[model samples]
Target: MKRIDVTRNWQGSRLDRFVRAHIPGTPFGVIQILLRKGLIYLNGERASGAARVKGGDVVSIDIAESDEASPPPATKPKRGPGKRAVKLPAAGAAAAARKKLRPAAVIGRDIRVLHEDDDVLVLDKPAGVVVQPGNRAERGSLLDSLEEYRRRSARTRPRGGAAAADAAPETIEEPPFPYTPVHRLDRDTSGTLVVAKTRPAARALARAFARRAVHKIYLAVVEGVPAEEE
Candidate 1:
């Protein structure tokens, strides 16, 4: 096993990000696999890429000497008229284009539902899963599974309710939302995700997240104890 010590500049970055910056020739997918297989350890404990690191943390890994690769070159931003507007196809064209898209079935094994209510659904997104369809990927994503599940659930769930006969015009609203993501996570950052099942819920959840009303916490394992508390 080879060991590396984290420096002050690398503190607070994701352990995986730090590895990629320092270790060359190892792809992220490989690193994740190695982590799962007990080939990688942080401070003598098995660690996930999502682990956060601090200065003086020790990383132990199995890698070749020649794999001391350099960091990848930075990508240049695309030049366009401001930001290029994504032109969604027209209705008829949209239908035709969608016909060519992959079948809207869950390509991955399953959607791990953590919680579900009338307004929102919570899921545990696995590390390797994508939340939505990518430009080049043919596999369906978590979004596709949710869409399919919603479509089927609508057939069983009751949609009819007592209509308020005396509602004011100002209170009227648009239609209910389809399954929509409240926020996004990087493809490899496996964690809890909240999705809105209705428009009202979406707005409320978005506001809550944006305003930092929701309490957030992170767990990490450091290689060595800090000499002083900050």
Candidate 2:
């Protein structure tokens, strides 16, 4: 638990951004999770990640020191010296990779489907599920599940309904899926996630987010009361 007072010069910044500036070595994802859980406060009230802070505001951040721990090591077997290298079939290799990459198939696991349509899908993701693949080997993520869903849906759609004469030939692509997430949510913070199903939709959604047209709100619990409001 730590208490920090915001100075006049630190006003007009997002709460997460402000905290990142002051705390060195703190991951932004961790801060986001804290903000979502109400561990961060502004003027004695729970603060959202998007909450605006003015100068001279007293912000209290209640972070549990134990929750921040290094990730476990990889579980793959180590290669031994002098082992004959055998080339696997390219197609087989690709399939294996996909299987390994298939994000956790844990349906109904800490996620709530908020809205679904042809162009987009919105979900309320719970804490601890990685939104996307990372450098590590952790499987099962929101993107992976969405990619699977997309494949199933594409299979069911009627084909040859409207083909563009000059359209480029379609090709098989890898999954992390074709859909683009308009924005990201922290692994430990549960919140709404918007995913675009098509390239055009993806671009439009991304632009909307970039322009701040999308509205987001986070709820958190704080440690103490504030002396004054901003």
Candidate 3:
């Protein structure tokens, strides 16, 4: 611990500034270290670096012997003492790189809902939008839209985003409402679609599609051949 006498020379000066002026070779960061460690005191009480030093103020500092002998960190000599200015790379390159990471598309406003109930929602799939994210998917797909729609349509948010546990006495049940697509259409395909609003409903609809139980028909169909009564 080193104690420094505050004289008229340091009157009205900040503690950190006074320390730096009196101790020429010390780095400014060292004073911060002492202040943060509760090692700096003024008038026998802990003080911050920002405290003002008055005449006859006895400032005490806890510091190692090496601290006094240590040399100041070397600074790079300023380029011509003031003409130093670093050049930054062009903004276009950075913008292009950022663009690649952003979603390739935003959900369009044209999505039309055809049917909605407790367990399912049927929509008119707009063409040129993907049913799911792909290897190069940037803007996201139809699934992204459904997820966003569900969040917005929810009347209340459950605790921790989970369904409220208070609804059940024996066990806490997680909120189980999420919109999931039962099947996928091509990115550019437009048609009637079915979306499940609950996990059980999703599973049932998925199974129906998997087992070829659900029937789909496209009005004004194009680019397909009809079975010739085979």
Task: Say which candidate scores most in TM-score.
Answer: 2
**Cα lDDT tens digits for candidate 1, 1-230:** 78889889888888787877776755665566567676777898988888988999998887652244323443454547654322212224423433554442222355456555577676667677788777646557777777778877878886535464445344666664679988886787776677888765777678667644454445555797887533
Q: Worst 10-residue stretch by lDDT in candidate 3?
A: 84-93
Residue-wise lDDT of candidate 2 within 106-223, one digit each (tens)?
Answer: 3346565555556666666788888887855766877777777777777988765445534757767665337667788888888767777766567667755654445456798777
- Clashes within 3 Å, all models in order: 1, 5, 5
Candidate 3 off by > 4 Å: 1-108, 135-137, 156-171, 175-177, 219-230
Summarize candidate 3's per-residue lDDT along 35-144 as a digit string, tens digits.
76777789899888889999999888777743654445545545575353332122243334335534332234456665555676766678888877766556557777
TM-scores for the candidates = 0.42, 0.45, 0.41
Question: Which lDDT value does model 2 have at 160?
Answer: 56
Candidate numbers, best lDDT first, in rank order: 3, 2, 1
C-alpha lDDT score of every prediction, in listed order: 0.66, 0.67, 0.67
2 or 3, which is superior by TM-score? Answer: 2
Candidate no. 2 TM-score? 0.45
